[model samples]
Target: MPSKSSARLAALTVAAVCSAASAVALTSPAHADSVRIHDIQGSTRISSYAGQKVTDVAGIVTGVRTYGSSRGFWIQDPNPDDNPATSEGIFVFTSSTPKVAVGDSVTVTGTVSEYVPGGASSGNQSVTEITKPTVTTVSTGNAVPAPTVIDAKSVPARYAPAGDTAASGSINGLTLQPSTYALDYYESLEGMNVQVADARVVTATDPYSELWVTVKAHEHRTPSGGTLYGSYDSQNTGRLQIQSLGATADFPKANVGDMLTGTTAGPLDFNQFGGYTLVANQLGTLKSGGLQRETTKKQSRGELAVATYNVENLDPSDKTFDAHAAAIVNNLQSPDIVSLEEIQDNNGATDDGTVAADVTVNKLIDAIVAAGGPKYDWRSINPVNDQDGGEPGGNIRQVFLFNPERVSFVDRAGGDSTTAVGVTKVHGKAQLTASPGRIDPADDAWKSSRKPLAGEFVFRGRTVFVIANHLNSKGGDQGLTAQYQPPVRSSETQRHAQATLVNAFVKSILDVQKNADVIALGDMNDFEFSDTAKILEGHGELWSAIKSLPKSERYTYDYQGNQQVLDQILISPSIRRSCKFEYDSVHVNSEFNDQISDHDPQVLRFRP
Candidate 1:
């Protein structure tokens, strides 16, 4: 699970895994001892026998992992200690194909060590393992220990415990209380065999043969069957990632709401990326739940439809143009104005000083027309080559596509990637000095991030100002399953500043002309209930349209197993008060296994 390919292992690197394990190379002559697996695991997360040698640690091989960088065998003691604080099972890191089989009774002699994935700077939890293990198989065909069943009754409702402030809020030193906290419950069974019956898939199976399931059914469930991560306190603790010990191609391809029919049992592993996971040797049978992608109703002629979609670094070389065009035309119902994010250069990511995306954008336009949609005119400001933070060479920027038959783009001169758009008064109304301009391009808040693109549009003779944004991502933030309780989100600082800048810009426009029709929307890389969203809606300057929907239906993205809000459409008070507000967080990709993008498009329909 420490590989970088899967989401559950993104935080781990080979350097970190090797360094942590090999740091304590105190190799002494092996001496027979009565030391057990639990003695090495100890009560806390760190091993008490760390930097020491343990010989003749008896256990039965429960699972064998013969591939990947972490190729090893999981040995679980048949006769576990009475205490639930320490794990009975431990991983034998052979560093290659293991000469062991499941049900083999064996004794291992190795150096007890703590391998911290992603390094110590990452604040991730360290897994206790026996590195450089010399194992001797005592017998074969021994019955494995019965798996500890994990269900709604076993896992506690409380997600985590507050760490001691004296230790910088880290829970590493604290004793595990299995009945008090869910994290502790999972940690108590770390590396030991566990099972969940009839587990419902929350996150669709990813491309890397990984999926997520929840042991606690109906815990903050969405209408689409995903567990909701609506607030910080409600982190959906029942969710657990699943990976198999068998062939990767044999893994099930499941979507959200699909069911795992029988018992899904395996070694409960504490991973760096997705927290506690089931490295399943016995996988569950798949059963479809009839989940389908949703399509929004077409906008009436009287009502204006505006949508924001992240095409996920669309380029001329991508084959998803037709699928995206179908999603725009057929699913989004050909919105009058669409703010498309992540539009790359013509040769997308081929950094040859080529910044123009006419081919890329026009090809999509052509696909849209071919899909029986209107011939939409587009406007965008090309960003500096490789300045925006995305794929290294992909100059991803926001582009606006407006149908001339329904709406017209208010194009003015002198707007470029570096030029900041200024709000001014014209005929007792608000107007942009340069249409299709970047908002505060020189500001430090937008450094290494996509700058907000401000564009002007006229619909039914009423001017609407749209600011499309793709702010700084949530990189470098500690995950939910860090060594520290309430993991730190350092990336929120930049996003908060970005939100404040956008809020000020919106206020500036409203200051000149009260009740201006302004809509700020895009992949905010945050939740609607987050502080970033609160800053964007500062002093009621803008209202997040996503909140208009019920809490169960507000998600636009799926991460791990929690359905959350990363894309949003927010409107000024003018549209909120004057127009009949209607918003839909479109569900096309986030809930499907075959996804074109990780984010779902959001559409708002209103009359002005």
Candidate 2:
């Protein structure tokens, strides 16, 4: 034997050389041709080679994601086969820092897999990928492939396929009909480079460096020249998501109705957030819409103004109290009686046994007085610990704040947090047995959700029954960018039930008194054209006050580039026949980046 140190070095060199030889041996194909990228990414939504080992997969590295948990690089074939439905590019999962460059040509050996983000409950589509890859570089400095153009001519006018049920819902089993539906068209261009030109902004730019756009001219436009969210039957086909690939500061800030000149070139990707996003490195110039904030004029004397506002999670610890008060005072014209929602308890998300909102409501009233507004008297019942469905530890409830000089509260006994209010005929008039009481609190529709608060108020010698409500939200529903065609709205079932209950209560009041001066208002968390609204308007029990305005000017909230109605005020037949009501949606929030609340309050001035 040789010396001790020399012998050890010789053994280590032998092991290293054997390791290099093993990698080449495992990756090299004996006599067969190399596997193409399209074969790995099949024509269907999922790959045919999933859960199988594949060798000699040749492609060029097109993109690299060096950060995050799912660190990987995307590879595309330099010469694509003649398969129109199959994609030529696929993602390789590394689970660490990526080791390849953008222009490197390589042959990879790995196991094919289908990765679903956030598990099965998310209802998101799975992405086909290669895991635990072994790479062998062949060349470098090659030219990238050209991007495919997507215009109005390329996309289909239809939205999705019919007869797809929620129990067995997927596009993987169906054939790709790119010329028939928008969802099919996007699936066909799944992992390819694409370009869009002369797009119109349909939604405002969000905080996540993303915006929605429509490539073609739209038929439905709002009064401000923005795109209107039509009914569910009319699907906006050419709509797409534009996501920035550069620094956050480099992205453009745009509002609805704005235009983007030139083209945006990027790779088409599907993720859990927004279904099909264009990850663009190059963006065009943004043309502004020149939209501005609006304020409503003050109400005339002797005209009682009733308003509804959703103060988003107001509490004592929050610092947005002054701004909200100013908006209510100046923008809303200091309404005589205001119904507020999302008012948290005194300790504000502390989770202790504190259920009183006196401190929270008092702070807002003090702020309003300092802003040169009149004194307001607030009334609300403290909720039991944490039954409401909202932020944890924050006991949120509905509250009413009124100008004591203009409107007087009609108080009665036997009203508590859990007691259900009963309706009765008093002197031939429908009246609440317990004023300011909860409506049907024991009903299944109100389980773990906000209960309707009913109050009787006397304004100018007329008694008006006001019911404050905040219904179930759209949290579990699919987004506008979901993979499924005509994305299913699963949250509507509960909202429909809630609407039925509210309709029954209204009918009870109208049965005793045909023309009861009823005004039901608050955050009804559904669209104006939704089924919930239809049930609320059944048999002409109440009319949506917002509908009295022109169609082009009937939105109280802005979300995802669509100005839609979420908060509404419904009036009785008597109120509608009068036609002496003036309605205004005070635009102090919902359009600007710096917003006090996510909603714009509504003020209805009528001589009751």
Candidate 3:
């Protein structure tokens, strides 16, 4: 069926920073810089031909997607020819396209390709063509700037660098790399601080911590048919792994493409991935004042604090805890307990040759040490080994984090890995009746499904059972049975099964303890109003963290222009009486320019 929708690859990108525009009113910049052609550096002005396409175009790459659904991407160069930085130039798109990602430099091109915003809709420019295409590397006059120590806040959280964005500082570019390219031009200038000018937002294929950008680099195919190159975007490339804490009182939201002028945490680690890669240390947002966050202060006996954050892709990957250890521990304000999904099996491997040889649970404990929070402790009732279930990184499941002083892990019950609750559990003879916007257990769709995790915890004098859930999603394999309908289906049978598992688990618990304080958190993977959600909350006494707010204010994740409540926190009848929840609207993957995980986190606050 030939759809009528325009099929042009539309890469979402922010505008270049200019004195004239506001944050939301972003416009594409123009590419119009003069090419002072020098013989590799001697400095000689090249003659400007009447219609020569060559120009010194520099800008943050706002968008990067395969051109025409092929294996190439267009680097939106906004600062070509220096014409107020509007959308201009085409840096070429090919299978051999350099590892240049979005949010980095779109420099080193010989000609230009321009997209006229909105041929149909005014102000929305689309790249129509590329006049010339050429590739370059550091060896070919593209001198990467020295590294520097910049705050995470200093870097633009969503905005790209404007042309002429000043360099905050400089570090050792060459010395930053423990190893370099054979040409000696250096791969990732580790331990060095360099400011890339006129940058723009790109995409983050990984989670929140990592970013992908575009820049001029030489790329070639290996004998195995894979292309090799390094990322040039500031967010992903030349990353300031470490930095001094920015204004200990405030942690600002990081902007996209902002130059991370910081030093490497250690020497570069290299393998087939690239010549070598370095980890950042002492990193902070480079912008003036970044996201404001305060450490937890001592509170009285009756004070209760709760929070929610999307700990992106909290897989069993060792890095889940390692990468954002500080954010989880310190920035998290030490919530009484954190409900997390995507906790992978300790012994899992990464597709990109990353991840240490450890399970996510154990590694998270270690990451707490790395992030300066040793007191944060965690556990999971669903004790699936790395290979327990057939997940990519072992059993990438959901678990919980607790402040040992505030909560303790007691035990687990209900469905095991082998005999997970499935469609049969949903049907059975218990209730043959199905209500409107309700899931019928008789549906064959949920015949096989992954059960939810129910972990018991004790806080103060009350017993709290926290169920960390990642319900069946809309996509994935059939045997996985992790399926759900998109956008509109309030009651998906498969999703209903997921809701059923949690319901059954809760029912079994209530049966044991009449007024058990139960808090179900993590990525439900379903919106608050969906049939699955209605079934979960149908019990009149239960409370949803987001239920207090209007529909617009309730969203833990965003997808395809629709904001849905996938990440949620549900409270049982007893807990909802005194403990009100505070759903912190932190940025999840998509809008925050992160691809860490598809779901966000939800926090619960209770007062004695």
Candidate 4:
């Protein structure tokens, strides 16, 4: 489960900027024709004359960001330059609120430097800036530069530059090729006045006062016209970030499949937040898609309903418990068995010796019961104090909540947080030697991650194996908003290993009984079209049930205006062969602004 605090922290990490040098006082006034803004901002990602002192760099102050440590005003050249590759605007890092007005024609004398937001360790591109600026007002009430129109024809078809490797790792290492790639196209326009006309919203508006839009018709548009967040192989080339430089109330609220009508014109500013964003003074009108909250149909009697949900760090102190319980009851229709993730300890985020989540789970169960749902029995093995990675002191782990009236748990001895589960044959049937046990807790792949909870259950005299997993999240991975070409998913390496381990365990059960009804599901933290999912569904040993949905409607998570799949239910060969199973990604959360969790729970109803 991705926490909003963590997401905001990541945004802050990207937004982090280097300390500015001492400000130089405006001692001398020079001619405005001495240096052009385009000359200062060359055709490359970095300034050609970086570290060199340039005098009398003249432009009209277009915008100002006075809030953060990197308080500065953006200046753009009013005169037109014939070279399409060279940007006419640049950011003057003043460190404090600039004294210049927005329409004031300013002449700045400063040293050009390439400042990397988030520092160099972040691997993000450097933003060309004029540091230690000495500002002089050339003229007042000057007209700003006309924004360059960015439409379908202006944006390149290729989204990113192909460096030495197939995927562009970092644009900072390679030279800029604006004509060839869309990233370079935007990079070339960095800090320049730009406009996106009639942009189609791809991602929903996030808490960061930003939204992603595509100027052109994308190839992977969803049924509702939102862009599908495909694999790393498919890039949304024309996608641009629309950032509001005004108050939060001014930022438009939009969902996937919505449109930004009229033209959004602003300066193209590069930062670690969302790569190249148009810092618009005013946003376009949000055209409603009329997308409403969705509910899954109730399960029939005798049908076993299993679901996987990442409750987003459920704790006794959190207020979202009732909402989550209502979602599980009314939206997921009170699944017979639910594989829950991120169940925090009794003390919640307290660093006390307590590692039990009994109180937390009980509160959710109580809420579910109050919501008119059946009383559910729960089971979970608390991880060693802070061994599993999540919010500090939270001690989050996987848990199971099952309706005892509908299904029965087969608990046996030797089940604990540290012991690994073993399988055996009973009456020529596959059965866990220790039901409700951990799967390979000592395995290297499970290090600093949630160990899978494997539980054996009986429904209508038939046995089923369920594994609840919360794999390593994509926290350390490069974002889609990064400067890299296709972007790097460094977080997948551990998830791939984790999937392999889970697959091996699933194989052990299937090897004992070839038609074993096994389900491995939870917040995988990877996509259905990802390599992690591929490894889990190796050679048809397990079938990803999410793929069974229409390609456009398969996502359970909404990210960056793209509906993506991060939660999944993978079934064994017997379940796939039965063809009697039904799966639904109950869209009660994720899409809505008032979402209880960052993910939407998925329910699979089948007759075994």
User: Candidate 4 residues 57-118, lDDT tens each?
Assistant: 88999887766566788899888588877888888888777898788998999877777665
The candidate, 2 or 3, that scores higher on TM-score is 2
Best by lDDT: 1
TM-score of each candidate structure, all chains considered together: 0.96, 0.88, 0.46, 0.93
Of 1 and 2, which scores higher on TM-score? 1
- Which runs in model 2 stand beyond 4 Å of their true positions? 1-34, 163-167, 480-486
For model 2, what is the alpha-carbon lDDT of residue 606?
Answer: 83
Scored by TM-score, the top model is: 1
lDDT of 2 by residue, 574-593 (tens): 88888888888776676654
Evaluate all candidate structures by whole-model CA lDDT and list the values in order: 0.87, 0.75, 0.38, 0.82
User: Per-residue error at 140 for model 1, in Å?
Assistant: 0.7
- lDDT per residue (tens digit) for residues 387-418 in model 3: 22224444455555666766665543333443
Write one digit per residue (lDDT tens) for candidate 1, span 411-507. Answer: 8998898888899998899999999899899899999999999988988988899999998888788888888889999899999999999999999
TM-score: model 2 vs. ground truth: 0.88
- Regions of model 3 farther than 4 Å from truth: 1-300, 303-320, 349-358, 381-393, 412-449, 476-491, 511-514, 550-552, 579-581, 588-590, 594-598
Ranking by lDDT: 1, 4, 2, 3
Q: 1 or 4: which has the higher lDDT?
A: 1
